[model samples]
Target: MSPERYARINQMLDNRQTDLTLCLDTVHKTQNIAAVIRTADAVGIHQIHAVWPDAEMRVSGNTASGSQQWVKTLQYSSMSEAAKQFNLQGMQVLATNFSDKAVDFRDIDYTKPTVVIMGNERDGVSDEGLAIADQHIIIPMLGMVQSLNVSVASALIMYEAQRQREQAGMYGTRQLDEAYCQKMLFEQGHPIYAKACRRKNIPYPSIDAQGQIEANATWWQRMREPDPNADEA
Candidate 1:
């Protein structure tokens, strides 16, 4: 990685909001998934959760690969399973639902360690999700359309969270684990080498200040040697 690239990646890591996250309760569209991931990255949210039981509905490798590289999407087999984990993490769960009791989306305190759940495109939030959510939120609309697209709603809510966080001075300081940051720096800065490490099961080497790989002689030797079983039956 070039020095400039190294600095840019470092800057992004510095602003990561580890506490704020989003949960997609089976929002299966590829375009929507990609948009949400990109928006999440824009707001410095390094992690998001998803509950997609159908393998086909999950975010594919090609969907927003750039954003996917920076944002980790933790997948869950069920919505309740994901909700329980959120509760365990002590996050205030807010679901975007259309209901009489739902509050204006902007009214919620986004400054808190929170997870905003955006439901599936058509069905909206499942009964299980609604039951577990700490509160139901809705974006007020002036016209006739009662709801926005899943991705659009997610972007608006995420930006609102970002605005609240900015006011609270939550950005600019690093909150991610040191090891995790190092891993991200290495993978993002040195994509080719990182790919090789995964392909060969080689451990990742430390990244230097200049974004150069700092590996022991053994690692260098391993990199030099091509994968012997490159092709097999």
Candidate 2:
């Protein structure tokens, strides 16, 4: 894809909103993580932050299914680090909990940069995670069910955020920073080429993935100046 193509796709993405984020707090289930990631991408969230002890972070190719490549996933050793980073970037952290003071998830503003923090399936968000949260949100349920699965709950909240953002016209304009979009699109469209450029410490060209020059015989000849003896013709 060329920059123009990327810009066009990004424009389409912009129409669906993009700033909402998902933060997983020590979630251990691979399937839940995978499902959450898939939902995050579908909802047009630009990033997902996974906060777990360094030793606990793990995602296989089968579990992640190239989704991690398409969406930026940040793994942090501590919730404070993740919270600080998002706060510095102007994101409001909404921790999900069942406390008396928790607000309904639908009542919060989703148009701004927001991070929805989901806790482990067994214990829910850690105390430290809750401590850093700007606000607590709860999903209201009345049908003999106390709570939904973490993945299902995440999807519900993400869709709600998407709905609010769409109505507020936050999705109607380009929300992604231009430089960041360019960098991500380049990496997505040309993984090998991008890796090569990084490994070789070469400056990447402004051209898009499809415009990458292949290193064929003609290219080698052009680079080295072909000798007459090397020509079969």
Candidate 3:
């Protein structure tokens, strides 16, 4: 990688938020998904958990631009499964839904570990998602239209989260785990090398300060070595 590219990768990895994430519940529109991914990357969100049981999750290249290549998007077979994972991590799962019990979006403390859920295009948050959410939040509307587009709503809510985290000094220092950061750098800086490492079920070779791989012939031979205890197939 070029020195400039290495510096850019380091800067992004350093500022990436570990606790903040997005959850999409059965949202199927390509453009909407693309927009959400773009906004999440802008706000330093590293991963997006999506529950799309009925459709294969795909992002549009045009709408996402290059963000589809940067941010990680994880697909889940069910909302309950996704919610359980985030809840286990102590995340405050807030679903975007308009309800009598819902709180204002701006009122929540976004500085804490949070997973903001964006509902499907037509139905909004699923019943399962609402049941799993720690809280339900809504963006106040002024016009005759009751609610904003899913992507638009997502951008507003995410930027608010970014603002709160920034005020709390979360963005001033590195938050991602070092081990994970190394893996990300390997994947981003030298994708083909990273793929080979994965193919061999071996840990990725270390990345130098210049964002270049430290892989050598010894590393490849080590990865190709057979397991000593393997039984006859």
Please tell me which predicted candidate would have the highest lDDT against the true structure: 1
TM-score result, candidate 2: 0.78
Candidate 1 per-residue lDDT, tens place, 84-137, comes to 888788999999998888999999998888998899999998887898888999
Q: What digit string (tens of lDDT, one per residue) describes model 2 on residues 19-114?
A: 578899999889999888878877777778898885666666678676665567889999988988887878888999999889999999887788
How many steric overlaps are in each model, in order?
Answer: 0, 0, 0
Candidate 1 clashes between residue pairs 3 or more apart in a chain or in different chains? none
What order do you get sorting by lDDT, best first?
A: 1, 3, 2
Off by over 4 Å in 3: 192-203, 219-233
| Candidate 3 displacement at residue 17 in angstroms | 1.3
Alpha-carbon lDDT, every model = 0.90, 0.77, 0.87
Candidate 3 lDDT over residue span 1-233, tens digit each: 78887888888887788789989989898999999999999999988999989878978777799898778999999988897789788999999998888999999999889999899889999999999888899999888999888999999999999999888888858877888888878888888767666666677888898787788898878666765445769
Better of 1 and 3 by TM-score: 1
User: Where's the lowest-lDDT run of ten residues in candidate 3?
Assistant: 223-232
Q: Model 3 compared with the native: what TM-score?
A: 0.86
- Model 2 stretches with alpha carbons more than 4 Å out: 1-18, 54-56, 195-201, 208-233
Question: Which candidate number maximizes TM-score?
Answer: 1
